[model samples]
Each structure stands twice: as C-alpha cells, then as structure tokens.
Target: MTDLILCGCGGKMGAAVRELASAREDCRIVAGVDLACQNSGLHFPVYRALSEVNEAADCIIDFSHPSTLPSILNYCRTHPGTSAILCTTGYSEEQTADIRDAAEELPLFYSRNMSLGINLLIELAKKAEAVLGDAFDVEILEMHHNQKVDAPSGTALMIADAVNEVRENNMKYAYDRHSQRKKREKNEIGMHSVRGGTIVGEHQIIFAGRHEMITLSHSAQSKELFASGAVNAALFMKGKGPGLYSMSDLI
Candidate 1:
C-alpha cells in the first residue's frame, strides 16, 4: 500500500482526494499539510507545513497552490526516496523550471489536467490539426467556477500547445481580439474563458473550415475524476527513478 501525505487538505480538490483515498485499499493518507488547519476535518493529523509531518510517506499528493512549491521542493531535498504528485496549476515559467530541476533528484509527476478524457481530447485535437492544417481555424473555450483565479485554464493552454506542436510551433495564441478591429489571423489560435457558478470544468475546441466545422469538447462532471488520476499517479510514482512525469507517462 502507498502511504500518502496530502497537501492543501482543506481545499475542494484536496478533500476529494482525501475521500477517494479513504475508500481505496491501495493507498491511505498518513498526514496532511494546509495553512487553514482548523477547518480541515481530516482523520489524519493536519500540519500547517510539510516539515512538521513525522509520518513516513511513500508519496506526496499536492493539490495546493503554486506558492507552496518551495516547501515541497525543500521536503524532497531533505527526505530521500519520497516521490510527489503535483496536481496544482497556475505556475509561472520560473516555477516550472524549478520543478524540472528538482525532478533530477526524485520522481515528480505534474499535469495541468488529470482527467483521462481531457488527455485523450488533447491527442485527438493534435490529429485534427495535422489533418486539417491551416485550412481550418482553431479556437478554444474553457469554463470554470467563479473562484478560479486563472483565466483560460491551464488545460486550454495544453490543448493549444498540443495543436501547435503539430504545426511546428508556428501558431501563436490570441487571448483577446476585441482590442483591434481586424479579421482573425491565420497563424493565431483564439482562447476564451468563462467563469460562473459551480462549473466543475468545461473545455471545447472548435475547428471551423469553409463548409465543414468540427468541434471537440470535454466536460468534467465532478472532481472525483481528477482525484482518481492523482491517486493513480502516486501509485505509479512508487519504485520509479528521478524524472519529470505527466499524464502522458501514466496513461
């Protein structure tokens, strides 16, 4: 069985992970780290930081914010033979680089979206881009709950990047076209975001041609899908070497 220490245990995703892991036989949460420790109704002891946790964990599942990355890196450095599965988003370029660098020491799994369907959608979109080429115009729309701080969601960017990879990275992202009155550029991919009440998650990729149009979409009905993915990643991290892994590696 995999012993896990859950980060951001008070958050919605963290709570989901906690519930799912509790019901499973392969893994169990040994500890939790969160700033708001008082509100965490976890059966396991919750610490304000990872450093205070004394339980031996085989892997860490972090659903926390990007700002908590430093402490996690430090934990990995100090504690050898422990792997981590990072499920958080909204990381900057420098922070992403840090993650890669730390991966040189221990196994780390990171992904923008953990849903299996979303990853499949990414692959399908790439195939569509290859077949359609420049003849079709690509646009991506993403919707999340109002509390989400990031616009366009990281999954939207992941989809755009996958499509652009097929075009030799020649396509540029156009976040807002309302600033100037001009026709849509052929070399740009449009990105749009919507924030409203209780939207678990929704991503739609539209490809418009002269006479034919194809749209690919993935909607997350609940947070359990992501929690399952994260737990599976943690199990996969066991008995692995140092490297930066993603959903591509697990699936």
Candidate 2:
C-alpha cells in the first residue's frame, strides 16, 4: 500500500482526493499539510506545515495553491525517497522550472488537468496539429467557474502546447487582441477564457481552414474525474525513480 500525504487538505479538490483515497485499498493518507487545518474530519494527522509532520509518506498529492510549491519542493528535497503529484495550476515559468529541478531528486508528476479525457484531448490535439499543419489557424477557448483566478485555464495552454509541438512553426499564444488592428498571424494561437456561473470546466479547440473547420472539445461534469485521476497518478507514481511524469506517462 502507498502511504500518502495530502497537501491542501481543506480545499474541495483535496477533500475529494481524501474521500476517494480513504475508500481505496491500495493507498492511505498518512497526514495532511494545510494552513487552515481545522476540523479536517480525516482520521489522519493534519499539520499546518510540512515540517511538523514526522511520518514519511511514499508520495504526496498536492492540489494546493502554487504559493505552496516551495514548501512542497523543500519537503521532497529533504526527504530522500518521497514522490509527489502536483495538480495545482497557474504556476509562473520560474516555478515550473523549480518543479523540473526538483524532479531530479525524487519522482514528480505534474499536470494542468488530471481528467483522463483531457489528457486524451492533448494527444488528439497533437495528432490534429500534424494532420492540419499551417493550412489551419488554431484557437483555444476555455471556461471555468467564476471563482477561478487564472485566465486561459492551464488545460487550454496544455492543449495549445501539444498543437504547437507538432507544428512546423511554433505558435505564439495571443491572449488579447483588442489593441492590435491587424489580420490574424499565421503562427499565432488565440487563447480565450470565459468565467461565469458554476462551470466545472470546458475547453474547445478550433482549427479554422479556408472553407471548413474542426472543433475538439471536452466538458467536465464533476470534479471527481480530476480527483480520481490524481489518486490514480499517485498510485502509479509510487516507488518511481527520480523523474518528472505527466498523465501521458501514466496512460
């Protein structure tokens, strides 16, 4: 059985993971790290700081804010054999680099979206990019709950990156176009974000050609899809060597 420590235990995603892991026989939550660790309702010990936890876990599942990255990375650095699954989004470029560096010390899994369907979308996007090429203009649109702070949800970027990787000329992401009064650039990938109501998540990729278009979309009905994906990733990552992994790796 994989011993797990859950970061951001008080949040919705964290709580979902906690509930699901508790039901599974392959893993058990040994402890949790969260600043607001009041009445967590979990049987495991909960601590405000990672340093306060004395028990060692095989892996840590972090659905916390990007601000907590440093502490998580430090925990992995100090602990020789622990692995981690980072499900948080909106990380700066530097923070992403830190994750890559930390991966050299211990196994680390990172994904913008944990839903298996979304990861499949990423692969489909890559295949579409290769087949469509520069004959089509790519546009990515994403919508999330109003409470979400990040624009162009990380999943949108993940899809865009997949498309860009297979393109002859790498596409540049354009988030805003109000100021520019020019025709659409051939190598530009337009990214649009919508925030309203209680949207769980939705991402659509449009490939516009001369007279035809292809649209690929994925709509999340519940947060459990992501939560369960994280649990699966945590289980898959147990006892792995020092390296960075993604949903693609798990699949």
Candidate 3:
C-alpha cells in the first residue's frame, strides 16, 4: 500500500481526493496538512502545519496553495523516500523554478490540470496545429467557477503552449484585444476567460480558417476526475527516482 500525506485536506479538491482514495485499497492517507484542520470527518490525523506531522508517508499529494510550496518542498527534502504530486495552479515563476529544482532531489509530479481528458486535448491541439499549419488561426476559451482566482486557467495556457511549441515560429499569447483595437495577428493565439456560476471547468479550442472551422472542447462534469488523476499519478510516482513528471508521462 502507498502511504500518503494530503496537503490542503480541507479544500474541495483535497476532500475529493480523500474520498476517492478512501474507496481504493492500494493507497491510504496517513496524515493531512491544512491550516483549517477542520477534520472533514477524516479518520487520519490532520495538522495545521507539515512540521507537526510525524507520519512517514510514501508520497504526498498537494492541492494546497502556492504559498505552501516551500514547506512542501522542505518536507520532501527532509524525507528520503517520498514522491510528490503537485496539483496546485497559479504559481509564480520563482515558485515554478523551485518545483523544478526540488525534483532533482526527489521525484516530483506536477501538472497545471490533472484531468486525463484535458491532457489528451493538449496532444490533439498540437497535432491539429501541425496538420492545419499556419492557415488556421487558433483561439482558446476557458470558463471556470467565479471562485477561481486565476484568469485564463492554466490548462488553457498548457494547450496554447503545446500548439505554439510545434509551430515553426512560436505564437504569441494574446489575452486582451480591447486595449488595442486592431485586427487579429496571424501569429497570435487568442485566449478568452469566462468566470460565472458553478462551472466545474470548460475549455474549448477553435481553429478557424477561411471557409471552415474546427473546434475541440472538454467539459468537466465534476472535480472527481482531477482527484482521480492525482491519485493515479501518486501511485505511478511512488518509488521513482528524482525527476520531473507530468500527466503526459503517466499517459
């Protein structure tokens, strides 16, 4: 069995992961770290800080805030045989660098979004970019719940980057067109964000040409899909050597 430590156990995503892990026999949550420490009816011990936890966990699944990244990295540094699955988004550039650095010492699995279908969408976007070439203009549209703090969800950026990387010339991400009243540039990737209601998540990519348009989209019905992906990543990462891993790696 893979003994796990869950960070941000009090949050929605954390609770979903805990619920899914509870149903599985191969993994168990040994401890949880959360500022609220609300218990959320979990049988395992929950601490306000990672330093207070005494359990030795085989892996850690973090759905915590980016601010908690340092403490999580420190925990991994001190623990010899632990891997980490980071499912947090909206990290600053410095924090992102820290994650890459930490992976050199311990196994680390990181993803902007943890849904398997979303990752597949990224791959499909890349293939479409290659086949359609520069003749088609790409635009990514994403919608999340109003509670989400980040604009243009990370998954949208991931899809944009995947397509941009495959092109002969990297496409610039254009988040705003209102400020500069000008025609859309051919080498630019348009990104639009919508925040309203209780949308779990929705991402759609449109490839527009002169005559016809092709669209690819994915809608998440529930948060359980992301929770399931994180759990699967934790299982895949256990006992691995120091390295950086992504959802594509698991696929």
Candidate 4:
C-alpha cells in the first residue's frame, strides 16, 4: 500500500482526499499537516507543521496553499527518496521555480487541475489550434467559485499555453478588452473569467472560424474528481525516481 502524508488535511480538498483514501485499499494516509491541526476524529495524527510529523510516508499529497510550499520542500529535502503530489494552484513565478528545483531531487507531480478531463481538454484545444490554424479566433472562458482569489483560473492559462505551443508560442493573451477600442488581433487569444456561487469549475475554449464555431469544454461536477486524481497520482509515484511529472505523465 502507498503510505501518504496529506497536507492541508483540514481544507475541503484535503478532507475529500482523506475520505477517498480511506475507502481505497491501495493507499492509506499515515499523517496529515494542517494549520488548524485539530484531531476532528481523523484516524491519523494532524500536526500544525510538517516538521513535527513523525510518520514515514512514501509520498506527500499537498492540496495546501502556495504559502505551504517552503515547508513541503524542506520536508522533502530532509527526507530523501520521498515523493510529492502538489494539487494547489495560483503559484508565483518564483514559487514555481522552487517546485522545479525540488523535483530535481525527488519525484514530484504537479498540475493546475487534477481532473483528467481538464488535461484531455488541453490536448483537444491544442489539436484544434493545429487544425484550424490562424483562420480561427481563439477565446477562453473560465468560471470558478466566488471564494477563488485569482481572476483567470490557472486551468484557463494552461489551455492557452497548450494552444500556443501548437503555434510555436507566437500567440498573445488578451485578458481584458475594455481598456482598448481596437479590433481583436489575429495572433491574440482572448481570456475571460467568471466567479459566482460554489461552481466546482468550468472551462471552455472557443474557436471561431469564417462560418462555423467550435467550442471545447470541461465541467467539474464534484471535488471527488480531483481528489481521486490525486490519489491516483500518489499511487503512480510509488516507484518513480527524481523527476517532474504531470497529468500528461499520469494519463
């Protein structure tokens, strides 16, 4: 069985992962790290910090915030051969670099969205951009819960990057059109964000051609989709060596 140390165990995603892991026989959560650090009836111990944890785990599954990145990195640095699956988003450029630096030593799996469908959507968007070429206008729309701090969801940016890769990274992203009165540029990709209610997540890629429009979309019905993906990622990291892994590597 894959022994996992769940970070941010008090949060929604952490709870979801904890509940799902409890039902699976292939993996088990040995300990949890959360700021709250309350027992809350969890079988495993929850610590206010990762440094205080004594459980020896095969991998660390972090659904925590970006601020928790340092502790996770330090824990992995001290514990050689331990892997980590990071499921958080909205990391800055420097924090992203830290993740890469950690990956050079231990196995690390990271993704903006853990949903398999979202990764598939990215691939589909890339293929559409390749087939439609410059004749089509590309636009991305993303919706999230009101509690989300980031304007454009990271998944939307991921889709845009995938599409840009198809065009040799020549595409420019337009986040807002209200500041400009000029027409849309042929090489620009429009990005829009919506926040309301408890939306799990939604992303749509629009490709507008001369007379037809094609839209590729993915809707997350529940948090279980991501939780389960994290569990699977933990399992996939069991025998993995030092390297950076992604959904593309899992899927």
Candidate 5:
C-alpha cells in the first residue's frame, strides 16, 4: 500500500475525501494537514500544518484553497521523491506557472474537476463540436453553493475552453443575459453561473441548432464523487512520468 498525506483535511471536500479514503485498500492515510480541527470524525490525527507531519510519504493529495500553493510547491520541490495530486482550483496565471514549474521534476496530477463523469462529458463535448460544425451554438451553465468564491466555476470555463478550442477563434464568455438586441454568435460560447442552495455542483453544456437542442449535464450532490476520483488519480499517478496531467489521462 502507498502512504498518502491529505492537505486541507478539514474542509467539506476534505471530509468527503476522508470518508472515501477510509474505505480504500490501496492507499493509506499516513498524514493529514488542515487549518481547522473539524475533521468529520477521522481516525487519524489531523494537523494544523504540514510541518507537523514529520514523516515522508509516497504521495500528497491537496483539496485546499489556492492559497495553499506556496507551501505545497515548496514541499514537493524539496521532497524530490514525493508526488502530489492538486485537486484545488481557481488559480491566477502566475500561480499556474509556478505549479508548472514545480511539476517539472515531480509527478503532478493537477485538475479543476476530478470527477470521472465530468471528464467523460468533456470528451463528448469535443466530439459534438467537431461533428456539429459551426451550425450549433455552445452554452455552458454551472451552479455551486453560495459560499463558492469563484464565479463561472473553473469547470465551466474548462468546458467552454474545450468547445472554443474546436469551434472558432471568436469565442467569448458571456456571463449575463441583459441585452435584448443581440443574437447568439455561431462561434461564441456563452458561459453562465448560478449561486444558491447547498448544491454540490452542476454543469450543463448545450448545443442549440435550428430544429434540435442537445444538452449534456453532470450533477454532483455530494463530495464523495470527487473523493473517489481523487483517490483514483492518486493510484494512477504512481509510477507515472513527471509532468502535469488531467482527468483526460485517466479517462
């Protein structure tokens, strides 16, 4: 079994990851680092910082906020032998570059969305864009809980970017719907967001044509799905080459 360390082991996603991690047979939770003590009744001791976890491990899984990057990258770079799964999202261009730099020598599976279902949808969306051609208009709608800080969720922009890569060069992200004198552009992908309820996450990609509309959606009601995917990624990254990877690699 591979020893695993979990960063952000107190948040909603962390609790979910722990619940799922407890049932796994391949990975062992050796260390847990979090800022909060609400660990959702985990068996292992959850630390308030990474330095408290004194032993080295095979891999580390991060589900914390983007602010956790500096220490994490530093940890990975210095630990040389340790690998990481970056499940945290919402990054600035500079921070992303820093992550890429860290992944230069260590194995990293960095992704905004880790659920296998969402990844499959991405593959399907790419195909739809290619087969449907320029006749269909692409629109992405995403919803998260009220506390989520990022608008249009990272996954939403990821899907829009996927479609845009195949659709056209004039693709633009439209966050609101206020204009009455405007029409949908064939090449532009409209992105929208909603914040309410305790929704775990929901994303829908629509291909609207003249006579028909095709919609593909992925609805997540709990973080268990994300936890499972993250664990799978941890398993997949073992013995893998040094480079940044996504869900596309596993799917």
Candidate 6:
C-alpha cells in the first residue's frame, strides 16, 4: 500500500479526493497539508504545514493553488525521493519553467486536466492534424462555468499542444478577435472560450476542410471524472521513473 499525503485537502477538489481516499483501503491517507489548516474527520491527521508531515510518504498529490508552486517544488527538492503531483494551473511563464526544473529532481505528474478521455483526445487530435492537410483550418472551442477565471482552460491548451506537434508547429492561441482587418493565419489555431451557467466543462477541436469538417469533443458532466482520473494517475505512477509527466502520458 502506498502512503499518500494530500495537499489542499480542504477545497472542493481536495474534498472530492478526501472522499476518494477515505473510501479506498489499498492506500492510506497519512496526512493532509493546507493553508486554511483544516481538521479532517478522516482517520489521518491534518497538518497546517508540509514540514509537520513527519511521515515519509510515497507521494504528495498537490491540488493546491499555483502560489504554492515554489514551496511545493522546494519541498520536493529537499525531500529527494518524495514524489509529487501538481494539479494547479494558471501559472506564469517563470512558474512553468520552475515546474520543469523540479522535474529534474522528483517524479512529477502535473496536468491541467486529469481526464483520461481528454488525454486520448490529445493523441487523436495530434494524429488528425498530421493526416488532415493545411486545407483544414484547426480551431479549438471550449466552455466552462462563468465562475472560471482563466480564459482558456488548461484542457484547451492540451488540445493545442496536440495539434501543434503534428502541424508545422504554426498554431496560434487566439482567445479573442481583433478587427475586421485581421486575417487568420494558415496554421493558426482559433481558440474560442464560452462561459455560461454552471457548465461542468466542454472542449471541442474542429478540423475544417472544404466540404467536410471533423470535430472531437470531451464533455464533463461532473467533476468526479477528473478526480477519478487523478486517482488513476496516482496508482499508475507507483513505480515509474522520476520525471515530469502529463495526463497524456498516462493515456
């Protein structure tokens, strides 16, 4: 059984994971670290600080804020052998670089979306981009709840990565339109965002050819799909090599 230490064990995402760990017996939720300093009703003890988690854990799955990236990376650096999963998004350029740096030290699984279905879409999208020619204009359309602050969700970016890898690597991320004078580029990826009333999430990738168009979509009816995917990642990563991996790697 693997020992799991969950970070951000108070928020909604954390709450869902907590429920999951409590229901499972193969792995023990030894400790929970959070800023709000929550006291969990689960069997394990909750600590306000990461340093207080004296137990040597097999993995630390972080679903916390991006603000904690530096500290989380530092902790993984000092611990040497402790594994980590980064579930936070909306990072700055430097923060993304920091994640790469941390990857050199610890086994890291960082993903914007932990949905396996979406990762499979990434694989399919990349293949489609190669098979479909320049005649097809690539576009990614995504929708989330109005509460979402990020314009382009991480899942949308994943899809962009998929398309960019196969094409001439000429995909542009356009969140909005400029003026009527604006002319779309040959390999530009038109990314559109839609916000609505409590939408779980929706992402669609369209490859438009002259007479026909192909679209690939993954819809999340509930957030549990992501939580389940994360769990599967944690279990899959039990004895893997030390390096940074994405949900696409799991798929």
Tens digit of lDDT per residue, candidate 3, span 1-251?
Answer: 99999999998998899899999999999999999867757889999998889999999999988888888888888998888899998888899898898888879999999999999999999899999989999999999999999988989988998998998557899999999888999999999999999999999999999999999999999999999999999999989999999998999
What TM-score would candidate 5 get against the native? Answer: 0.91
The TM-score obtained by model 2 is 0.96
Query: Candidate 2: deviation at residue 196, Å?
Result: 1.3
lDDT of 1 at 125: 100
- Per-candidate TM-scores read 0.97, 0.96, 0.97, 0.96, 0.91, 0.91
What is the alpha-carbon lDDT of model 2 when measured against the actual structure? 0.90
Tens-digit lDDT string for candidate 6 (1-251): 87888888887678778787777776767888887855846567788778777877777888777887777777777776677878876777788888888787678898888888888888888888888878899899999998878878878887897788786676767666664367887868888899999898999999989999999999989877777777777877777667898776787
Q: lDDT, candidate 4, residue 49?
A: 90
Weakest ten-residue segment in model 4 by summed lDDT: 73-82
Cα RMSD to native, each candidate? 1.1, 1.2, 1.2, 1.1, 2.1, 2.0
Write out the backbone clash pairs for model 2.
none
lDDT of each: 0.92, 0.90, 0.92, 0.92, 0.84, 0.80
Residue 148 lDDT in model 5?
91
Q: List the residue pairs that clash in candidate 6.
A: none
In angstroms, how far off is 158's CA in candidate 1?
0.8
Which residue pairs collide, candidate 5?
A: none
| Candidate 5 error regions (>4 Å) | 38-41, 168-170, 179-181
Winner of 2 and 3 under TM-score: 3
Candidates 3 and 5, the one with greater TM-score: 3
Question: TM-score of model 6 relative to the true fold?
Answer: 0.91
Better of 1 and 2 by lDDT: 1
Q: Give the clash count for each candidate.
A: 0, 0, 0, 0, 0, 0
lDDT of 1 at 55: 96
Candidate 3 accuracy as TM-score: 0.97
